[model samples]
Target chain A: MREFQLIEKIFKPLTKGCDAAQCLADDAAKISLKKNEELVISKDVMVENVHFLSDDGGFKIASKLLRVNLSDLAASGATPLYYMLGFSKTKDCDEKFLREFARGLKSVQDEFDLCLIGGDTVRSQEKFFSVTIFGKVKKWQILSRNQAKEGDLIFVSGTIGDAFIGFTKACESMKYFSQRHFFPTPRIELGKQLLAKKLSKCAIDISDGLLADLRHICHASKLDAEVFLTKIPFSIHAQKILKQVQDGGRVCSHPELVSGSKFTTLDLLSHGDDYELIFAVNPKNRKKILHLAKSLKLDLTCIGEFKKSTQKKFEVVLRNEKNQKIKIKKFGYEHF
Target chain B: MREFQLIEKIFKPLTKGCDAAQCLADDAAKISLKKNEELVISKDVMVENVHFLSDDGGFKIASKLLRVNLSDLAASGATPLYYMLGFSKTKDCDEKFLREFARGLKSVQDEFDLCLIGGDTVRSQEKFFSVTIFGKVKKWQILSRNQAKEGDLIFVSGTIGDAFIGFTKACESMKYFSQRHFFPTPRIELGKQLLAKKLSKCAIDISDGLLADLRHICHASKLDAEVFLTKIPFSIHAQKILKQVQDGGRVCSHPELVSGSKFTTLDLLSHGDDYELIFAVNPKNRKKILHLAKSLKLDLTCIGEFKKSTQKKFEVVLRNEKNQKIKIKKFGYEHF
Candidate 1:
């Protein structure tokens, strides 16, 4: 199908009820904010083989792309409003692929109450999708990473390392792992609850793993952090995988893991794509946060705390269950 | 350089002095809109070896990407504010290329009084750049293509077909053509003047060639348009190229043009990449618009008028100087 046909037949319907979209006919979209509201925006790009397998269906690829971008807004404590997509379709992306992609987008947009606004669609040899999301938050209420105060208790929502294990298992035809790897919850409600209840003012999403993202907060706040390995939350599946590796069982078949190296629990802490929210809260508000978490039915774990740093360079210390500092190399994934 | 180092050493400097950018430290950027103001947003993506030559320098590629996206905001009569960029770099994009790209972005951002707010940088096998730009316009003042009325005079800013000629000549190492093809002026001020003075309420930027873009307005407004070939403004260089093609001179060396076919004037009207503004104005405001154009030192041509369409599918008729209708096979470039 031609670009216009794909837009008219598949993408245009996604903007049906959005008056601001202007039926996707205008050159650009116009949006208005309430008097006391401010706009929050973020963009994320995903390549075909680098980010997802080429054989992955459009639905899975589209869902992961939108979810990761939504995670950014969730970290900012903003409500999702709209999104603009830039898709460069490869030769293999036919009408069926586009239809499924649009369906996936519609599913997420319906769940988040956001609509498509404007974007560009083109053809390329290598397929990649980029999304720019716009959300709204109360004036002066944006939660930033630099707001972490000294002596603040650190917390992370949901299970960690599941995505890493899921990625490994998915490569071996594991459905559960594939599902976990592809469909991540963005924690939008928890983000808003934390800000609205004044429970926390500092937060970052765990896209680049726990330690690396925590270091981002520490670096921004000009402080240091200490995280206990035992306190880090892990799912039943991830724990089983860790046990198998520790018991001299078959290690992960991933190229990076199987190349003359043993797979260890530390690998879980350093791998990314978890999409969970890690935040800092005042010690006084700890009970309130836990209570909020119980009401929301989310697993909120207190894994660490922020500390004052005398040195200019901030550091994140990971300690073992025995209370000994664990030496580490390579915090998380780094794209060059 | 690693991704973080590249961002810290190069791209982060582009966010300086933008309070909303948060020193490039946050997951998302926050923006506040004044009362009676609405946000205008647009996105454009350019792929190497497709939208541009792979050998093109970062400065030229960066400038063209921003300019094309800015043209969308110009069509909506919006004032530039902020932008988010998503770039996928190939192995060939070294530190020098990134520095040059940043420099080009700084040049345009300074001239346009805008700043980079947030973006993502990642690695890819094929390089591509996507930009999402944000601007502001007064409430109820956005120029929409669907607002054109019957008897509205069709107007075009600057010249047409220069970019096509430039594309052709640049393929043969013509410096003048290379400059024209690489750099385009976005008609922001003219769009603002038209809307502020109530001279027009309909406009579409000519990125998809003259007839194709005019058809966009006609399709949106449910009207037909008639453009006279003689009245269509063309630069001296474009005129020379057209004369050469007519006189059977050395035809363009572009692969598409030289493949057992004669390059004609119709190809010029059907080809795209000209970032000029095509708009509609009330006949009564023609003199005022011409006056405004003279003050701005821009050539604004009155090429045609919109007429009521009897059929469902709108048509754009091209008339020769002899008042005879000219047939065109393709309207403009389409990516499929």
Candidate 2:
């Protein structure tokens, strides 16, 4: 279908909220506040070779790019209302390529029902995809990274490591998991529900990974988290990846045992695009929130708890095969 | 001065109509409007090699990209409020390159006091820039090209072809006249005054050139134009460009002789980043509007009048040495 047609048919249904969020089909979208909502805006950059491959399928890259931005929206338990896109044109680009690019934009925008209010397209040697998403939260519903506090329960949605596993397979030319490395979906509904019911106090999406992204909250909130390594979510295919890493001359342990330093396989488990919601919920609302999510088709898991700052007191906690204490060196991924 | 410090200092005084704009410095900007304004958002893309050469100088390219967006805002007579930028990183691109780029951004934003809201940065092989400007105008003051009426007078600021001359010189390595091409101010005060007085009924920015842009207004208004070429205020340097083209090969019996079939010269007038204002003013307001602009230290010239139709008669009236009208071929800038 044509881009406009696709936007109308597939995407227009998603423009929701108070009168502030006008229908998304207009050339320009306007949001007029009915009550109290703070507009949250975030922009993310993904470049070819840096964020994706030039040879990567355009649709996948475009959708994943949108997902990454939407993941940011979920961080605040906000509804993504609008987005602007900036695409760098390449020499090989032409009208047809742009048409397809627009179509792909329509698809993801439609999936989220986001209004493609405005953006820029320009030519460059390498492609850069920058999508800036806008969302809104009632002042009370806003969950900032700095709002995490001690005694708050840390929770993550669904599975982790799938994205990293997919990335590893893509790097190794293992055809089976290439799709996982692309076309990641952001947990938009869950985020909306979280805000709607006041379940999350502070949250962020696992775009960088559980460790790296969680560190953002911890660092900003000045709180520390002790995640039960045994409670770490693993993909159904995680065992296969752990086995592959073990075959690559890395000492391994039973992942369920959570014992010993697992630095070698940490890369496979720590760094990749995971658009799942990572939220901190009040301990009192845990059961109610879990039940609410179940009715809303969202799976929830509590993985850890927050504590006072750990910078002054460093400790490594692990469990042996017999469930006794042992030392585990690495926690997660680092961008630097 | 440091980039952010320069922005913070210089932009402080020029802030316009910001009482309602959600000014988010170093984070994200937001605008919450009550009524009578439909947010107009548009984006344009620029890339090295495709939009400019390596020799274009980084600062000029950066300013030019921003100027184009401001021009878009200027056309709609929208209050140029906030802008978002997207950039690609290359191996050769260091913090130094970025500091200059950010300087250019801050300069433009400060000059117009256009808030730098948010943007994305990524690594790439060739430099690319995409800027999206957001502005708001009253529902009635939202001047669009399609709203011009027959009998409307087409007015533009300053002269048209200077940008083309500066462009040609820059292409030919000529030193002089390059400054005008580098920074064509977005006629902010002129646009706002026009909007406030509701003098400009319909408008489009003259990024394409007077002829082509006028053509667009004529098409959108469902009318044609009877342009008086002699009335146009040609810059002294444009006279030099006209002299060269005429003295070289474009000799004809008519003073308003035609050459350069693609309107490349006029295309430079109309084509890329000239931030001149093109508007259709009601015939009754012509003299008073001109007086008002003069009082504001700005120049406005009426070059053409709208016609009923050009569908059956595409006539180009070139003035002979005696000022008698003679038939000539028609041409203007091309947009794809």
Q: Which ten residues in a row have the lowest lDDT in candidate 2 chain B?
A: B250-259
Candidate 1 lDDT, A1-336, residue by residue in tens: 888888888888888659788899986988999999999999999997778876778898999999999999999999999999998888888878888899889889888989998888988999899999999999999889999999999999998887887776523555556676788889999999999999999999999889999999999999999999999999877787688778776456554356434567887888888999999999999999889989999999999999999886789999998989999797887877
Candidate 1: residue B252 Cα off by (Å): 1.7
- Model 1: runs farther than 4 Å from truth? A170-174, A254-262, B170-174, B255-262
Q: Tell how far residue B237 is off in model 2, in angstroms.
A: 2.9
Q: Compose the digit string of candidate 1's lDDT tens values, residues B271-329.
A: 87888888999999999998999898999999999999988678999999899999889
Q: Which candidate is the best by DockQ?
A: 1
Per-candidate Cα lDDT values, in order, are 0.87, 0.63
What count of clashes does model 1 give?
Answer: 0
Q: Is the docking of candidate 2 incorrect, acceptable, medium or high quality?
A: acceptable
lDDT of 2 by residue, B33-86 (tens): 545565666667777766666566667778888887787777777777777666
Q: Candidate 2: which stretches are off by over 4 Å? A: A1-38, A94-103, A139-141, A170-176, A247-264, A310-336, B1-30, B34-38, B56-58, B170-176, B248-270, B310-336
